[model samples]
Target: MPDDRVEVEEEPVSETRLSLTADCGSCFGLCCVALPFTASADFAINKEAGKPCRNLREDFGCGIHTQLRQKGFNGCTVYDCFGAGQHLSQGTFGGTDWRREPKSAQQMFEVFPVMRQLHELLWYLNEALTLAPAKPVHADLRELLARTEALTGGSAEELARLDVPGHRQQVNLLLLRTSELVRAQVPGKKRNRRGADLIGAKLRKAELRGADLRGAYLIAADLTGADLRDADLIGADLRDAQLAGADLTGAFFLTQPQVNAAKGDPSTRLPGRLTRPAHW
Candidate 1:
């Protein structure tokens, strides 16, 4: 018989900064309105940009928050704006709601995506500074963080007109160097699967430690019990991947969206900033 011990519910170990995570209570339903989705394997229904989801409540909460997946809204769970929702709600917009100020709606919606990108970079740069092996690039990381943070705090017009891709390229260079320095410590042939299309491939229990899977398409792939320790997962597509018991310690740029999309067990060890999803 099982132990029958009452297991304490631990808050999922989150690897992201609090400011970078969605604060639904603080946000004003910007994500529900500003962004759009399409009917696909990822999203349940089609939604055009600049239009609010039909399920958005007057209080800016999802009507199906609890039954999102069961109600054919699984895609809602995978979408993450990297805390840009609250940042635009309370920070950039100064707590002024777009619904009340209809004129600001277009600008706020446009700038939200830009802010999301900026915050995402901030997350990466901030994580880069935490790696002891990446200490050599700490100064550069700080500079990049400062620049990205400034962009997040910019006015809607400034954010809408920002050269975000250019800035991201600069940050990516630093992240690439950081990946090299950190992966060197892990012994084995370092696998470079960057931007490779491996959709639905079977990779169960694979020796993937220190592998570079940046931008790789692992959609719905079986990665059960895989050893992803010290792997570079930056921009990797983990949507619907099976990560039950997979070790993702020190995985770079492994955001909540990717994690939420994947399946994992409570025993699965995560990086410092990653949060274990509840559906595991």
Candidate 2:
């Protein structure tokens, strides 16, 4: 899986703040091999899990990386491992490439998804700590972050048996609290659309400020020119959503993958942390 190929400044992440951005260079192309994808608008071919993508180079780089979208690999452009690939390749497996250590191939592949989930949790927790409104739960968030980070360092066998869903539930609580704290700062009535199926819904220029859009299916929704400031957009499905000129400034928990999937432009107001997709 190729990462969101957006050009931006790569900052040095602190020890406490894990790098949420995907670093494919330091990885062994685990996602390209471990994950399965069917032919669709996003992918051009069908590949089984644990099968290395034909486009994967011997050096673990994508053969057509620069032309991924052109070659019908749009899905690859939006997939982000949140730095899990490098961590698993170097940290968990001690820099042992699966191609060399054939015996550990299956374990490494199985552990990839688990580590990705843990890293995603760490990303959310780290962001929660930065919000001034979420200060009340900052300590609790840090504690959970430490615990989650510790889990990421677990051995392959330990990670394989981990209760990822249960762990996600625990992290979601703090993230929910953080969302409430942050959204409360916005004035007036806020919409509660959490987990709502608004696929392809026409929401052009809608007043969605401080809306609770967590886990909402907004796929291909027309959100052009909408006011989304301070919205809680965690886990929102934004694939092919029309976001041209929408205001997402200060939106909390809006990950890069979501932004990359949406159709945005120069006028789209994004939070500082995320970069504009190249194709947009």
Candidate 3:
């Protein structure tokens, strides 16, 4: 899959804090080459790892940067590397460009996925630390944050050999605690919607505030005008979900891919660090 440039907002993220955001200029198109994809509703063609996309430019920019969706490649618009690109292109490899140094290409490709997972964990840890009610686990969040951040600074070999899923399992425990602490503030018993198959379910104008929607298969579900504020959407399959006018303010762990897959409009509300998709 091809990669999109990072969306910037003055308050979305702070560069000095820890770059848990993409910096495409500092990357060598790793997301485009290091990842694999097959023909799907989201992608137009099949691409194998370590091979540059046909649309990749000499300077590593997407040739179809402004028209990815129209060209049948909405997957690129949805993908986020969480700043792993620059970390490998610069930090782990000493600012090396894979193009200039072809020998480093294989190693960089191999390590990119591991770095991406670590950076995603950092994204969750950073969000967990920001929640006020999660103070009970602040100390633990900090410890895990530091530990995950440290892993991001490791050498290429160290990153490739990392036990990423093991690290994620530990951090996920802390995040679950954070979710409980935050959702407890809402004035209702949380619903257990975890991994439920709600495909094409009519949920328009539903009162779902503070719902624990983690891992729900809500494909093409009608969520229009639903009160999804503070909803836990981690790992939710929202492909083609109707979110037109649905409130997602403070929705936790919602990724760009989810937003892109869903149907929405300008009236739809979003949390910080997320941009409205153009196709909407």
Q: What pairs collide in candidate 3?
A: none
Q: What lDDT tens digits, residue by residue, belong to model 1 across residues 1-280?
A: 2212111123233333348777888998888888898887656888998999989998999999998888788788888877888988998899998888989888988888898888888778767766667777878877777777877778888888899889889999999998887777677688888898989989999888889999999998999899988788999988889898887876766788889888889877787566787788
lDDT (tens digit, per residue) of candidate 2 on 185-270: 77889999999999999999999998999999999999999999889999999999999999988787888999999999999998
Q: How much lDDT does each candidate structure score?
A: 0.81, 0.89, 0.83
Model 2 weakest lDDT span, ten residues long:
1-10
List, residue by residue over 130-169, the lDDT tens digit for candidate 3: 6667888989988888898888888888888899989999
TM-score per candidate, in order?
Answer: 0.91, 0.94, 0.92
Q: Which numbered prediction scores highest in TM-score against the true structure?
A: 2
Q: State how far residue 80 of model 2 sits from its true place (Å).
A: 0.4
Leading candidate by lDDT: 2
| Model 1 stretches astray by more than 4 angstroms | 1-18
Per-residue lDDT of 129 in model 1: 67
What local lDDT score does residue 233 receive in model 3, on the 0 to 100 scale? Answer: 88
Tell me the spans in candidate 3 whose CA falls farther than 4 Å from its real position: 1-16
lDDT, candidate 2, equals 0.89
Clashes of each: 7, 0, 0
